[model samples]
Target: MENQKLILVIGGTGAQGSSVVKALSESGRYSVRILIRDSSSIHATELAALPNVTLFQGSQDNQKDLHAAFTGVYGAYVNLNGFSIG
Candidate 1:
């Protein structure tokens, strides 16, 4: 991986996102930034404990937030949290 490349991880506090964070962080390869709606949320706080993990306020519907989160991002992992129809 490139040095200091930012990877913006959407829904990083949820189940799948959390696993991604762990894998990325443990590898010590890329920088991970988590986009969360609430900074004070439990999952947000948990993710904040990991090294090289930055948490910022963001939402999918808000284009501005998405843009801000993706600024200087070398990669992005978008994890939609809604349930799917069977």
Candidate 2:
């Protein structure tokens, strides 16, 4: 799968992130790595069950975790926690 594009998705267990993961995974064009805080959580477990979707245990608050998640990824989709009207 080296030829496939690697996309790192932060907050992939949340509602917004889960949608993005589903969409991208269905596209069959990219491999997705989801950054989740708890691998044993229900959402994380569900996402991990999907094909082409791997879970990376980490947190946005840690620079080291973020750095590790960003490695070798062709692209990234970061969804921070908050509500905003735009």
Q: Name the top TM-score candidate.
A: 2
Best lDDT goes to which candidate? 2
lDDT of 1: 0.85
lDDT of 1 at 13: 79
Mind giving the per-residue lDDT tens digits that candidate 1 earns over 1-86?
A: 45867899987877899999888887788889888888898888888888888888878778999889999999999888676311
Query: TM-score for each prediction?
Result: 0.88, 0.90
Model 2: per-residue Cα lDDT over 1-86, one tens digit each:
56679999987877898999999888888899998888999898888888789999988878999999999999999887765312
Compared with the true structure, the alpha-carbon lDDT of candidate 2 equals 0.87
Model 2 reaches what TM-score against the true structure?
0.90
* Model 2 alpha-carbon drift over 4 Å, by segment: 83-86
**Model 1 misplaced stretches (Cα beyond 4 Å):** 84-86
